[model samples]
Target: MDTACGKEYECMLRITEEILLLILDTEQGNIRVSLPAHTRDIVIAGAVLMDLAMEDRIDTDLQQLILVNPIPLGDDFLDPTLADIANATDTHDTAYWIARTAERGEQIRQRAINRLAARGILETEGHGPVFFSRLVSRIRRYPSVDGTDMEDVHVRIMRVLFSQDIPDPRDALIVSLAASCGVFDSLLSGEERAQVRDRIDQVARLDLIGRTVAAALRQHTPSARSRKSARPHQQIPCVAGWPIAGHAFAMSRDLRIFLTRQYQRHGPIFRIKAFNRRFIVLAGPEANVFVTKAEHVHLRSNELWRDFDAATGSGRTVMSMDGPEHMRMRKVQAAGYSSKVIQNRLDDVIDITRRAIDTWPMDQAMSGFPALQRIVAEQIGLLLTSLSPQPYINDLTVFLETLLKIQVVHQWPKLMMHWPRFRQARRRVMELYAALLVAHQPENRRHRHSDFIDDLLELHRTDPQFLPETDLPVAFLGSYFAGLDTSASVCAFMLHVLLKHPELLARMTAEVDALFDRGTPTAQGLSELDVTHRIALETLRMYPIIPGLTRTVSNSFEFGGYLVPAGAQVIIGNTVAHHLPACFPHPERFDIDRYQRGRAEHRKPGAFAPFGVGRHRCLGSGFAEVQIAVTMATIVRETELVLERPHRPIDIKQMPLPHPAASFKIRQVRRRRASGTV
Candidate 1:
């Protein structure tokens, strides 16, 4: 091979450089001695395949890698690998080559390190006890004659991964390689990894080669092979009573109570035949960890919520999407609810809350649920659509309430949805949403301020594929549907909890008053109200609005000593987990202090599930938090509230949102004194 060809191979260090940096622990300045052998082999083998593709020596079409050139690349590390592929008599696929190459991964790894050492980019030393005889190396970044440190390569790669900069092909390949091997955690500290996780994930998706390699690994892994061969050992424990309708009626009546009773009888993992379908229910923190962390292929959200698709609409909202489509939509929607955007809208949120409070009758008793629902609906309207709920507030509230009911009892016969009253209500709600969409269009929009609608419009303008025109109305209604009822339920429950404990309410009131005395409620000021924030968190833990989350299992797996078969539906009950004596000690108590910095009781894994978890966690969590906190704080500071019927056990509705019964009433009187008075 000629020197120019050798130079070309030498300059193409895309794969090798990624492997070296990943294998090195930057803090310790040495090779990560704890790197597992199997993972290391898989990553190195993947790197070799990527390098070959980048060199134009090979290419893949769907299932197989076709050799494009048989000529030697003139680099010792790659030339032999190329030769092996060229000499193969049988037509081979990508996975076959990856496995074949991985058999010699240790040799490939050593040679790459030796090349780096020769270039003074790394220093090696004898490691382990004398008899063991192994080499340990540390990266060296000393400035070369060209005045560039070798370490700059690592920095440049990370910068490309973290920044919005469009990465060159090489850096994109590196990110794909790292993500495929699951080595991101090894390279970055937990905090640092979180900060750049989204960007890294975006970049990783760009590398088709890496994705193919990862898919191959998943298919051929020992676990996959064993799962394919093994049959489920025993039948999953099933809840008793109701064969045809199964446990559907009981589950819909009160999921928390039903699940808790089943848990007591069947332990952590059990099956409930519900709505003529079997659901595998997993409860507690261990179950939380297992379900949330399961592979996307093993469990999916869209399939679980399929029954509601007709009522909710299909392929038009975030909740209906799975995998890459869901992820892409989430990225676009995140812009509207980011901390910066929420902060910008904080004043509007506070003003809306204050207005709702002022309109409440001063002395007459009123059901807290409607008052809170009205306030929450108005606030969601202003923040999400930049529209006030004037002339249509009642209509909008009714629409949302009906939609929530339909979602909760969505399993009813298809004919029920087509009933005259139900269909009319559905049509009315869609018309209201359609009107909102039309009013917010670029040509028709009256308001100048930005909101979620504006953000989504911008996305649609820039990338038509990001959100289709048909989905515009559904997306808008979905955001409102998600926030309005859930927020109202939480706010009502908070009022109930506060009225039950006047002292606790007093402490929270003081905290809010102190913060507002400093200045108006800026995002920074609102965040400082630790007591109020804790109250919001504790309320959700005790009465999670959506008590249970369900998913469909795509791959069979073992959990809590039971084998959950593929194609089964799984339900994880947040209410059940929250009340576990093991998780929250005094399970029945409402202690806001549990979420205080020092206590942080909810920090225990799946103990708190108000916003759900993992990929399916509520997108509006930040929006929900800010909306809840500001509303609670404003009420505490501006009005003196007392339950009209005190000590009435809070009757929580079991289906839809865990709303307090309408009988829960409160009497409010405007504070006589000004800002700081409590």
Candidate 2:
């Protein structure tokens, strides 16, 4: 431990050599790595990562495990002498020495070995160690599989430890366990994901092992289904625009008006300049058919999502994926989110929503985003992970916010990958995510719940071969992240808009009261909230979370008479498209009346896509509507909200958020029971 003689550096170099010995246990697998040969260093590098996993310091979800290959190692990079590192015990010491003396291979080898050896699980020759053996034994004893073969268990445990999945019968059990422990999703390549698929098939092929298991796992595979080609879209006027940015762009309202003019002036289709890109805004039903229904002609929502990011911070989410890969991932994640699953957990969401809404400080002015974030996280913990953090709500909100900014807002430096800011953001997001995996996973489940985490863990255990792993968590996280802020803001907007126009509020309150008098706001009660639903829809249309959706043209295609260049990006303006007067009479007005009980005819087909459309449309739309409807109903039922600065010309400088401080106070009317039920 003494640094006085500067012998610490010399002492540190020897530990890496010791660590390498610990990583190689089997007689046949052991290989000499300290030599100056080029291949020798590379071999050492390969063992480093596996060694790290064996010790369990890093979880199975190590995100960048793929980076281990094309192993960056050489003799020059790993020049540590055996004498210099011999007495230096501990992984950090070995890593430091390796880092100091070795450039690549030695550094990796030292880090990997030390990570393991530091934990006191030194490798044994031709056998498992006391600590590792004990851990593995305990895991195997956990009763995940009833009849999975022993050899199969051993092989799977071995494969799982190295982040390689074994296809033996026990993989289902092991995968479930890994997911429960907050193991990160393995950054599996297409091949690895496929290999897992085949292994599951093998298990299914085993006679009388139970027939449905393999098929179940197969359902979760990204490549499970064969996709059909998109049908040819009917010809409609498809105008394209490539406008160079002028110094003076139109105001937000002007842009909205301009888009309306383009739709009106150009008939069914036209194009306009938006921000830095040229948006090809279309009108009429065919526009919807083209953008949403057509298969290969996928709708892009990045532009809309950017505005969303401005509010919710969710651009990097898996929901941001596009084209075939995007659709595949969505389908795999969707398998877990079937109606049966939702119906089973409807009560849980309702309970959580009620508590969250009750906790919403109506007396004092506050931001709804933080509270909404809590609901999102709570749902994720219950629905996906089965373990939601209670005291760390604020921290979780900030973390989610941080992820959003790092991803959606692109504020955390790494907006551009080449920039140092991006590097910092990368470090922050990765570290935050790793810490979350560790934090959410407490040992031996004293604090477990029947949440999504439990569901996934159980399924993964029962059918690891078919499990989507952490994608459920990711999807749930994404939905809440993608949904909460915007929905809450819409709720906030609705509250503001209604308060400004008390007649509308009175009508909504009466509708809710009528529905309540008949029965609780159950599935049937929501059907009666048609006027309320219209008001909600109109709010979404007028001040949609995103301005438009965009897609990068992946293939050369023709829309109407326009030959859209293959690489060109397409923009579908939702907000503007909604405002086109030809589509909606008196489009500038905030008329909830358009969708009211007496006036339901205004909802035209293909005209009202508040949540976008198609395969990748918001999966949480139903959930979000319930949340918003419930929250809005609760606030209206129990309190009267009043905007401090009463009606004058309230100018919305920002397109999405009317204002930041956005203060309001609510007066208690009467206490209502748990009246709303999904």
Candidate 3:
């Protein structure tokens, strides 16, 4: 019936009466897709697929597709063809291999049918069927997880039919993400839905494109099983049986171990899962494109805070706003903490650092981390215009090593928005800053002087739009909390590195000593020391700040020649990227010369971005660098450190641990040495 003709247009959804052949397709029934003329479009889905699948137990439905797409989109029916395609995925391959051992087993038969349809196993008019030899030839050209490694199953298939190559990984990944997004149809906005479709197209194109694709680009897993609560977040629906590896229950042991293992094995940007969200951890310069790129699809502070809340059970203590709102507040308030600006408070920084170091008893023999913590405390106070300017400086430098406990990490205050206590604590923290904010107003008599707070207050009064009520809490809370552990921990690591390698330390020391007298430390002297500058970069490369940073897609993102769906959480493994062969030459070797050496020009902008990238790039990067370099150089010039006792094995998971329950142990080696002297 032609609708254009205005006749009775019978939109026929043909329901054929037959013993419906419901083929169990993808592993664990994840990939179940219906053939065409079916009501649910492969592109569109409805209701909870698992609920419908289970309804079979109570209510009998005569006709069903069974499970076709292994990453089930809509419901109960599992079709064999697409499921086989998905089962060939990493997590499912073993099951597929074992199940298919029998001669033309049900699983294997369904697979051959789908692969034939997808790859033209038999001659058909729709695309144009090809013979088995053509299938072999097509197979040879297809992409797979380990493109280079021809697994036994693929080899058996090749030998069983004729020789054929592995299928493309991108093809598998596309089918996976597509089917994953198909669930929860009405909820996603029209634009977001389109973006997912566009990604499916891009991934399809990529799968058929070329060869030797990186694992981050090609390797992915879709979750096949269903959960009880079935939140929208879970229905993120893994496609192609892609690795939605582990979730809330399974996160503890596997997540951290998996991350470090990926770092050791895959370079960076491989996928990972945590608390039910699939995340890809990116690293090095390659990750910069996501963070610092013009595209602007990132996990804004508020989004990050949302996850933090999920983990912590609280929110709204600043660092949550995103896009123009975040930029507006930051622009108005940014000046107070700029490198040049923070430097004026350098007098404060120096005074605090000096007193903390000077008062230390030589015999105290503390860890480098403790000293770094003290420095961070000093920096925080200086940033805040610390009351009394001297006493609180020492104790405030807490080794927050305690904050990194796995239990605390899980109890993120923002997670339980429904909880009243969590909400109140957040309000209380914001209220504390609110009182301080009143004094920040230039017109307010309490803020007659031009401290950072006062300076921002003046700007707020001057610019009509600058007054975001949320700004005061965000800026101050952001600065205060940000400065504490990140800097201190890195400083400790850097000093420890220098102290361990005497020659490198001595070279750096000599450079710093030449700028001014042996022990006189200042920012100008630090600027003058090029060697010190070079070494600082090397130190960063070896032990970077924030092992990695996390981001979630506000909208869909196309990266590394693959389209990632909206709402998929991602972690840019900055440390792993730095260690990539493409980014750094001989990445494992810690040669300080890379930065200051002949190929010093090799260090590109986004390549070594420890402060991270995109719209959420670190605001305090320049400040942190100067602060670290000056402090480390100063300490080197003053005394040499000797590790009295080495630390127990460090937990890379809780890396960048700000404060430890106990201080590190090191003897101070003064220049005019007696026993522990330089």
Provide TM-scores for the models: 0.67, 0.51, 0.54
Q: Rank the candidates by TM-score, best first.
A: 1, 3, 2
Ranking by lDDT: 1, 2, 3
Q: Which lDDT tens digits does candidate 1 get at residues 525-558?
A: 8888888888888888887887778787777877
Once model 3 is optimally superposed onto the true structure by TM-score, how far is the C-alpha of residue 102 displaced, in angstroms? 57
Question: Which number leads on lDDT?
Answer: 1
What lDDT does candidate 2 reach at residue 539? 80
Per-residue lDDT tens digits for candidate 2, residues 1-678, read 001112322222222343244333222222221222233343343223222222222212211121112322222223223223333353322223322232365345535444444433332211111122233334432111232212223344446544544443324333332222112123234565565554433433442211221122222222323755432332334344334542114524444445555566666555555446554445444565455534234344444344434333333334555544454344344434433344456456556756766665545555533454566556545654454545545443444555544554334544434455444544444444454455455474566544434444455567654444543344334434444455656666666677778888898998877765664456556656776887788887776665544565555555545555555555554455577655566878987767755655345555766665554556556656666676576556654546555654444433322222233433333345553542
Best by TM-score: 1
Global lDDT of each model? 0.69, 0.45, 0.45
lDDT comparing candidate 2 with the true structure:
0.45
Model 3 agreement with the true structure over 1-678: per-residue lDDT tens digits: 001111111111001000011111111111132222121221121111112222231111122223332453221123332344345433332222222332123233333334444433222111111122234335633222233322222233223222233333422322332333332132234675564554444443343111111121122122223434423433332322224435433334333334445655654345555545667555445666445533243454455555433433333423555655555444444455567655555555655666566766675577566567667756764565332213333322221122233223343333344455444555555554665666554456543435556655565568635454444444455555566666766676676667667788788877766754644445565677776777677766666665555566777644544555667677665555566656677877767777765676335545675555554556667677778777776576555567766454332324323233344567865633232222
Q: Report how far off residue 411 is in candidate 3 (Å).
A: 5.8
List runs of model 2 lying over 4 Å from the truth.
1-244, 247-258, 266-285, 295-317, 320-324, 335-363, 368-476, 514-521, 596-603, 648-678
Residue 379 C-alpha lDDT in model 2? 58
TM-score of 1: 0.67
RMSD of 3: 21.2
